[model samples]
Target: MSVFAGRYDGRCAIITGGASGLGKLVAARIVAEGGKVVLWDLNPEALAAAKDEVGATRTYALDVSDPAAVAAAAKDSADALGKVDILICSAGITGATVPVQEFPIDSWQRVIDINLNGLFYCNREVVPYLLANGYGRIVNVSSVAGKEGNPNASAYSASKAGVIGFTKSLGKELAGKGVIANALTPATFESPILEQLPQSQVDYMRSKIPMGRLGYVEESAAIIGFMASEECSFTTASTFDTSGGRTTY
Candidate 1:
């Protein structure tokens, strides 16, 4: 049960990467709070499962890195939800952990494509719907790696940094239009995404956290819930830190 009942009543949200991890959890939270959601992910099977698990109103399987796909999904999402009041861009990947000199060119391109370019496409396509309604919330998921620049994870770090910069620009553009945009920078969190990294890399990330521990999905989801709600009326063009003290700024 949600502590803040009806916080998202009558709201409609489109959550990219809604198949798992933070996105899936956030979807469940919004549904529990009386909001409608359309889940988008690259994995069709996972999307189906997530739709059932989160009680999502609709689900779309598409690669967020594809501009055409994102554009189409945005239109379909708006059609499904009637109006998109919230957009949580949570699709991302931790590319191969390797030094810049040794980083695979394809890996780098994939990281930037999905994490940076894909977010841009989603935001570009959805902002019109938000503007039409005169009210909306955008939470773009970034990472503390963007700020601290994690070693051997150059692509992930750089891509996330782009997310931060892009979100700032978008937030400013949408300011005073009743559509708030912000970025979420989370430190090393306990998530399935970590499974992609080596144990050494995970250890390195955990060591950077002053809390001496990884953050839980629920902790970050709680923050996102507020950011996506009507209560987040005044804050825009800002970054919310959930870095377990790894990033103070």
Candidate 2:
């Protein structure tokens, strides 16, 4: 009954932001599929709670935006999990929302550092492990806003768009090397991040989605799971949109 089909047996997966929300769901799914999971998060308490709930999970408490921390975690993960077969760059922040003219420079930089630069850190460090082992799959979580920039969310939108571009470039570079790099774009999903937004903004976002409802974290996780699986062998530098009809690009 498992759609994972034992494709992940004996493999190791690293998911940044795995302490909560979509990342948490993805990590749980990876374990369900017989893969070992190493969760990287900025919050120590959340990581501890997640490990308690998930059981048998390796966790690293570190900020994704810190390249040194990311690199160290990558080395530790390789040593602990035996070379990552899958890497999901899910660490992101929904920064201060305001019109472009009023957007704070610091906030914009914060979002970019984590969503864009942090993603690069993971790819840089993890890919070597994959390349050395001759195989790997990566799914960077982008957003519907990345495809069509949303009003008042310049920072998040821009950072995610960069992630999409980064994924494509990496996928092509390692195309013949057995490493598959792809990005997933999902419409507003039900998550703790939504709880952080003003209700008005939340309703505004939901209305734009053709589905008329926020996506479930588990649904996004399943799609990402497939992309990380060996069965997803044909796609690279591709964007798999889970936009609920909110995407045209």
lDDT of each: 0.94, 0.88
* TM per candidate: 0.99, 0.97
Model 2 has an lDDT value of 0.88
1-249, model 2: which lDDT tens digit per residue?
235646678889899998999888888777877888999998899999998776535899998888898999999988998777889989999888799999999999999999999999999999999999899999999998888888899999999999999999999999989999999999998888886677887888899988799888877888998899888899999999887889857
| Candidate 1 per-residue C-alpha lDDT over 75-104 given as tens digits, one digit per residue, 9 for 90 to 100 | 989999999999999999999999999999
- The Cα error of candidate 1 at residue 97, in Å, is 0.5
Clashes of each: 0, 0
Q: For candidate 1, give the lDDT.
A: 0.94
